[model samples]
Target: LGLASCKNNTETLGSPLPLNKNYFENYLNARYNEEADYDPNSPANILREVHGLNKQGKLITQVSMFANRYPSEDALKLFGANEGVGAQLPQ
Candidate 1:
């Protein structure tokens, strides 16, 4: 019964959205519990992170840019595949 309920909950949540500015905002909120303020648009908040926002404000980090033109789960998969294959990337 618990497993079935959890499945239904996940189904109702729908498909996951790609990593984007809004997602980053929510993540920061959850991670810091609103104690440490973070601005998703600030370079300081994004520079050291795994994701980056382009001029148009999308999570298309320097690394993921080579994988796909747009941000999506498939892009992440492609990036992972490239890493797995030991693709040489610029420093």
Candidate 2:
């Protein structure tokens, strides 16, 4: 992540999106105590797998797929749990 100049005096900084990937990996590693089986349906797995790709579009797509596969309430709960309160999944 790098800083960039914006039109205004305020500057734009690189996003800390990769932190989500790191957090997911750490959670899985700790929970499983070893390499966990790859679960495509798992949001953590999706984030971990896509982390290296460094493509925001791809990451968003994977998250969308995960949300689509589950009920809205379940998805929202899972998202909020991982991403913190009031974090809304894309519609």
Candidate 3:
């Protein structure tokens, strides 16, 4: 969401960490349309309610949550991004 969430020099506004912009847009649009039409759990619900908050530009909001969801380093680095949003940051 901001510089605070960007620890990787390779990640930035221009470089979006290889996320699907279409899914991201759909995810953002889903926030406004909450119903069976946007069920996050559905694989192909036409619209998703909440797949990965990262797809909605709110990864920062789910930073801690993702950590618990993905505790392993390799796991977190994969689907769950650290982006300096875990439990540490340079003071």
Give the number of the best model, judged by TM-score. Answer: 3
* Best-fitting candidate, scored by lDDT: 2
Q: Can you tell me which runs of candidate 2 are displaced by over 4 Å?
A: 1-68, 83-91
Candidate 2 residues 62-82, lDDT tens each?
121221233344444554343
The alpha-carbon deviation from the true structure for residue 86 of candidate 3, after best TM-score superposition, in angstroms, is 9.7
What TM-score against the true fold does each predicted structure earn? 0.18, 0.16, 0.21
Error of 3 at 48 (Å): 38
For candidate 2, the clash count comes to 0
The model with the greater TM-score, 1 or 3, is 3
lDDT of 2 at 81: 43
Residue-level lDDT tens digits of model 3 in 19-71: 45554465555432222223434454323334433322112222212222223
lDDT of 1 by residue, 2-73 (tens): 543344232232434334665456545542121234456566656645454332333322321232234465
RMSD of each predicted structure: 19.7, 18.7, 18.4
Report the backbone clash tally of model 1: 0
What ranking emerges by TM-score with the best candidate at the front?
3, 1, 2
